[model samples]
Target: MAEHTAARPRGRPPRADREQVVHTALRLLGEVGLDALTMRRLADALGVQAGTLYGYFPTKRALLTAMAEAMMSGCQDAGENAATPREQVLALARGLRTALLAHRDGARVYAGTHAVGPNTLGFSDTLIGALRQAGVDAAAAVQTALLIVHFTTGHVLEEQAATGADPELLTEIDDLHQAIAQGEYPQLAETHKELTGTDFTQLYERGLQLLTSDVP
Candidate 1:
């Protein structure tokens, strides 16, 4: 194998790291979303030729994976501050949500990429280790960690997607549902107020409890 390089072209600035590339990519992601992020765009943002990015991220999918993994790394100590394993697990789940929510369409970006990278692996290792310390078998520990990841990622995607909907339209739809329920579905009408008031935080906590209930 050959060593990678970041040789700048004439007039280009000197400072560049793999992390810098991801950061620039993330900035563009916030501006234009995942669909518009491309190596050429990133290169233009970073003041480098498109070929420079290939050395760091061979393909667009690879760059996406790196970005997703970078997001995961932000919550590296997900459960580190907690005293008990259960608290650690809860912390990890909550921490992941907070991290993902920090970026625009973060959950969507993360869910779509394959994060078989150091940051993602580190996150998994932390969860698995926490479970193993709590007496779970290795296989079960891995599975539990994955369960938390999958559930939280999916939940956040829906939560973010819901937030992105047109607020006025959402309100109109809610009102329409309530009006219909009042006449046609009396049972639904009775709980329509509560049903429409979806609290993602409460739902996330309950989900964490349910998912980790069997961890012991």
Candidate 2:
């Protein structure tokens, strides 16, 4: 009788590199938004088992940090052509906002994760350097950089939330108008048009100017 051999178990699929993983995650984030872009889903998209991803990114937070870093790549270059320190800071802030708005749920992905990667560090260093060049003290420069970043990210977060024809925002505006008409908010009645304006670009630019007006 011929000897019978047992069938061997299949091994896991080839692992994806860090770059591929991050890019794929970003694509999925755009497709399904952040909450649905789970590790299992990412693995299925990559043709690998979920456990295999842990080899490249030990935790979901690690993967998010990598994605945040990828999104921030080249943001520092925005300030390269700026002629003044204040201009450089504004350029960098604008670049960051643009980067965060590039992907769906982009601001959400970047909001809380602490990405210490080269790109993130480079962006931070460049912004702080510009602030320092503007005659800011080291401690104050770091603080100012943080304040700028916070403002940009927060604005982008609201911007993204107000996308897709934002019915909720419309309702809020309507409610504000009604309140003003009822004489409940005298100041709002006077400036309701500006308060309810949808021109986020103008709003962001104005806020940036206010923040940096004292820089020099």
Candidate 3:
């Protein structure tokens, strides 16, 4: 061993490039919240050195933007699918739910980020196109998609927040049921099961049916 040489840093130097690095960084953002995602962590996740990540994402804000874009890409892919507009709308709702559920704190990550990514806009195009194909008027069709997205996101937020299906809410319902059985609330007691029980999945599907049923 003669002369000791230092190992050179890996990855490209910072250039005015965007797409590839943005996409990779966004994937990590979708997995972990922006605050939790660090350059070193991204490098570890990407199997590259921290230096390489810096070349792509100069700062955390830049990285956050990339994540927002990645999350919306699903709509882009959905638009290309052969399914009908109604099906596509429902698919997007389910897809949003799936994506939010995929990573920890997903909904929060997307909550205030104003990312109008192509993938998201693509899904909107598909939803509107399919809705038009199905005879839903332009305005209503747009509103319908917005409603679905809003509800889906809100539902996911609650889903992730609950420790276990919201025990307090369930306990309150139980109290109501007890009051009903004691004849303090006869009509409510008569329909206690119906009131106290819910199948959110079926409810979500039913909501979709009610919303998109304008097609005939």
- The top-ranked prediction according to lDDT is 2
**Model 2, span 1-216: residue lDDT tens:** 999999998975678887888989999998989889999999999988888889899999899989999999999999999999988999999999999999998888998888888889999999999999999999999998998999998999988887744578778878878888998787878898887777999999999998887799
What clash count goes with each model?
0, 0, 1
Better of 2 and 3 by TM-score: 2
Q: What does candidate 1's lDDT look like per residue over 140-188, in tens digits?
A: 8888888998999998888877776456858876777868666878777
Show where candidate 1 strays beyond 4 Å: 1-16, 165-172, 175-187
Worst 10 residues of 1 by lDDT: 8-17
Instruction: Compute the lDDT of residue 187 as modeled in candidate 1.
Output: 78
The true-structure Cα RMSD of candidate 2 reads: 2.5
Positional deviation of 6 in candidate 1, in angstroms? 29
For candidate 1, give the lDDT of residue 51: 85
Please give each candidate's TM-score.
0.81, 0.89, 0.60
The per-model lDDT (C-alpha) reads 0.83, 0.90, 0.67
